[model samples]
Target chain A: MNSSSSGNVGIVIVSHSPKIAEGAADMVRQMVGNAVPLAWTGGDIDGGLGTNVAGILEAIETAWSPAGVAVLVDLGGAETNSEMAVEMLPEDRRARVVVCNAPVVEGAVIAATESSGGSPLAAVKRSAEEFYA
Target chain B: MHDAHASRPGETPVPLTASAVLVNKVGLHARPSIKLTQCAKGFTAKIELALAADGPWTDAKSPVKVMRVKAPQGATLHFRVAGPDGKAALAAVLALVHDGFGEV
Candidate 1:
């Protein structure tokens, strides 16, 4: 994982199950040393689309202390819900939001571990920069 | 450009690289792990995983690989792509991971 470390970067990871989110977070702490802010979401098995856009916005807003925040998600309903939450963010904060393309477990761990010294956004960017041409 | 609605034809894969960051407080578990594995299927790329030295890393596209790799909050993962649409595959994976899956 590689990218430019720019500003404060918080992170939100969504999944269809709460266990997945927790598991990813556990991995992240192992990697980056756990100085950054992180969150998680999981849909109910009943297909409740358990993602709370408003809650996410609130968490991002609160987490947006020094810099901004980035979001990562697994496939299925989580993707749709994540995209919707992005729209919910304020126009200005939108630029701060970054949606990565890595898997939930892998992405969370990388972002969490990489976000040190630099801004969370910067760390996240670094964690995500390798795919660019 | 390939049809957005139509699935792209399968072909030999190439290699690309992308990064994934964890944003959830709880971290990666069963539900998210499976979904991530499913997302990898969208691409024809061969995905491999590497953790941030202290964390777990495995095959990005395989559920079994994912299960083998175990990580918690604040971790980061490296995904190397090898397939037909390595670039696109890498991009998509990065986006999904960066977005935090819209979780709390």
Candidate 2:
């Protein structure tokens, strides 16, 4: 929500419902404070590509570049969409992305919020490790 | 059968075996803990976490019991099931833990 942090990795949360994406981001903000960059793809973003493979690719091109991005998504469309995005990512950059398994909103928030101070890849790995542990 | 066992009353009884793995990440957060406790509530079993030998094992069926434990990543937990379906229940839980609650 806050665009002030310039160098941090961009985290995108996708859900069928915009409200849910907001809720997930909000939870993360509450825990670590608003010091990370966040964007939403599924909720209110124009074009159906927000949660789709194209949308993820666009977000990567637009936001991740110098710093890679991490994505957390809800169930249903969000899940399949993340998987598709993974397939589309270039093999070299694939390591930069991660899909969390926190169970919809909870997982997204945990992944996005925890993605600060460390490498975006590390944050995402930690989230995945925690969720699966 | 009763007479045979009674003849050896002084002998120690064999302990029952049960095992469960740590399923939830973040080491058993409230939501998953509640879910596990609710599942344990259905039947009567002496459920307890196999904490470090020095640490006391807590009841698995109690939400509070699970909350007290701060299990981290890759930690394997054990459950003591003793009831009608103790063996079956333990087996199911073992499978769930092995699967990492469907996440892994």
Query: Model 1, which residues run further than 4 Å from truth?
Result: A1-7, A44-50, A119-123, A129-133, B1-104
Q: Which portions of model 2 miss their true places by more than 4 Å?
A: A1-8, A43-50, A61-67, A90-92, B1-104
Q: Could you give the CAPRI-style class of model 2?
A: incorrect
Over A2-106, each residue of candidate 2 has an lDDT whose tens digit, in order, gives: 443656666777777767766776765654345567766664346433356676566555546346677777766777777788778889877777666656555
What are the lDDT figures for the candidates, one per model? 0.61, 0.58
lDDT of 1 by residue, B12-38 (tens): 333466567777665565445545755
What TM-score would every model get versus the actual structure? 0.47, 0.46
Candidate 1 per-residue lDDT, tens place, A23-127, comes to 776665554444567666665545465665665565466446346666677775666767777788779877777777767776666555445444347546555
Candidate 1 lDDT for residue A39: 67
Clashes of each: 86, 1
